[model samples]
Target: MPRLQGVDIPTDRPTAVSLTYLYGVGPKTARELCLKAGVDPVARARELTEDEVARLAALLDKDYTVEGQLRRQVTQNISRLRDIACYRGIRHRRGLPVRGQRTKTNARTRKGPKKTVAGKKGVKDLR
Candidate 1:
């Protein structure tokens, strides 16, 4: 495993693909990073020299917020939204879909399991 931005990238994979193991980096970003760092995108991570690893790590640290830092930034954004009490923030506060998806039917993921309530008993039942 190759460590980049505190994440373990699989050594068997190409550097381009392995870079995506870091949070906030997708395939496109990975390729771009490899190009910027002068690393061979197709080369396996295990084949990288120490100098190459140092260059890649430096490039990422200088230009990107990833891993735990990225996660904290995202959580802070959400918390800020909630503190403002906007519609989307309210949705987040309620744990409902934030993008205006119809909750009346198919929001099971956010709404969780249905809670059944017993119907009112009728007078006829006493007869």
Candidate 2:
């Protein structure tokens, strides 16, 4: 594995694919990085030379907000929203879907497991 920006990219995959392992670098960005670094995007990560790795790392550091920095920036943005108590901020604070997703169904990922309420009594049973 090649360590770039404090993350270990998979050596078994192509360099472009491996670069996606780093936070905030997706396929398009990975290809761009390979191009910018003058490294072969299709080359296996394990086959990259030390100088090539250094160029990739340097490019990432200089041109991109990635890894810990990106994580911190996102958290900070959310926290700022929370502090302002906007609708979106409230959603974030409450652990609900923030993107106008219908919470009536299919929000299990954000809403967690269902907490079923007790069924209402039947009219006959109440009588």
Candidate 3:
């Protein structure tokens, strides 16, 4: 196993495909990182030398706000919404659908499992 950017990379898979396991890295970003670090995209992660891993990490650190930084930015955005008490923030706080999707029928995944309440006489039950 080779470690890059504090992540243990799978050596058995192609570098380009395997590097996606790292936070904030996708296929396209992995390819670009490999190119910038002078590593072959098709090379196995385990086969990389220490210098290669160091170079790759350095390159990514220099050029990208990845992993913790990116996660923090997203958290900050949500925090700002909460601070402002916006409608979207309230929706997020309630853990309900925020995009105006029809919740009367669908959105069970967000709303959790349906709980049926007993209906009054002559009233149809709505699940």
Candidate 4:
């Protein structure tokens, strides 16, 4: 494992792929970082020299908001939305999908297990 920006990137994968382990960094961003840092994207993480790792870390710290900072920024944005009572904010506050995903069917991950309600008549038997 190679530690970069407080995260340990997997040594088994290519540098580009391993860099994606950092928060807010994806394959595209990782490739861009490698390009800017003059690192070989296809190189394995363990194969990187100290100077190369230093360059990668410097580029990320100087030009990108990632890891804890990115997470905090996102949470703050969500909280701002919630405080403003926006539609998306309400969804977050209510623990529902926020991106116009239909809740009538496949929102189980957000809605959690169905809460069974006792019915007055034959509704229970319908199950």
Candidate 5:
């Protein structure tokens, strides 16, 4: 594995694909990085020379906030929202969906496992 921006990228994968292992770097960004760095996107990461890796690191540092920096920025943004008590922040605080997804169903991912109420079985007798 070749290390870039303090992260070890997969050596067997294509350069563009391997770049996606870094935080905040998607396929599009990886493609752009390869283009700007003049590195071959289809080449395996391990095939890259030290010069190519240096160029990539320089480009990443100059043009993008990635790795730990990106994660910190995102966390700060969310924390700022929470501090302001905005709707989105409130959702974050409550651990609910923030993008207006229906919570009545299909939100189990955010809502977590079901907490069954105890009285449902006896409700039929009352009725």
Candidate 6:
């Protein structure tokens, strides 16, 4: 496996496809990166030489924000929503859907499980 930007590249796949394993990097970005670094997109990750890896890493570091930078940006986006205190912010705080989707039916992933309540008449007298 070739390591780039502290990530293990999948050696069995083509460079263009394998590079997508890195956070925030997709197929297009991977192809562009390989081109910018003078790497062959069709080559397998394990075929890359040490110098090629170094070149690719340098090019990526210069042109893109990966790993920690990407993570921080995502965190900042969520934090900004919370700081704004808008309807969306309230939804985020409450762990509910923020995109105006109807909660009467689906959206189980975001709304979680429903609470069951027994009807008043269903209760029997213990005395």
lDDT for 97 (candidate 2): 88
Q: Clash number for every model?
A: 0, 0, 1, 0, 0, 0
Query: Against the true structure, candidate 2 has what lDDT?
Result: 0.92
Candidates in order, TM-scores: namely 0.80, 0.86, 0.78, 0.85, 0.83, 0.79
Model 5 residue 45 lDDT? Answer: 97
**lDDT of prediction 3:** 0.84
lDDT (10s digit) by residue, model 2, range 1-127:
6899888889999999999999899999999999999999998999999999999999999999999999999999999999999999999988888998888876598788875558865458554
Summed over model 2, clashes come to 0
Candidate 3 lDDT, tens digit per residue, 1-127? 8776677888899989888988899999999998988999998887888898889889878988777788899889988887899998888777778788777886597778765556645657889
Residues 25-86, candidate 4: write the lDDT tens digits.
Answer: 99999999999999999989999999999999999999999999999999999999999999
Q: Give per-model CA RMSD.
A: 4.4, 3.9, 5.0, 3.9, 3.8, 4.1
Q: Which runs of model 4 end up more than 4 angstroms from their true locations?
A: 113-127
CA displacement after TM-score superposition, residue 111 of candidate 5 (Å): 3.1
Q: Give the per-residue lDDT digits (tens) of candidate 6, residues 32-104.
A: 9999889999998889999989998898888899887899998898878989998888888877788898788
- Candidate closer to the true structure by lDDT (higher is better), 1 or 2: 2
Winner by TM-score:
2
Query: Which model, 3 or 5, shows the larger TM-score?
Result: 5
Q: List the residue pairs that clash in candidate 1.
A: none
| lDDT tens digits by residue: candidate 5, 16-116 | 99999999999999999999999999999999999999999999999999988989999999999999999999999988889888987765977788767
Global fold similarity of model 6 (TM-score): 0.79
How far is 18's C-alpha from truth in model 6 (Å)?
A: 0.9
For model 5, name the residue pairs that clash. none
Structure candidate 3, residue pairs in collision: 11-46
Off by over 4 Å in 3: 105-108, 111-127
| lDDT of each candidate versus the true structure | 0.89, 0.92, 0.84, 0.91, 0.92, 0.87
Provide the global lDDT of candidate 6 against the true structure: 0.87
Q: Please report how far candidate 6 places residue 127 from its true position, in Å.
A: 8.0
lDDT of 4: 0.91
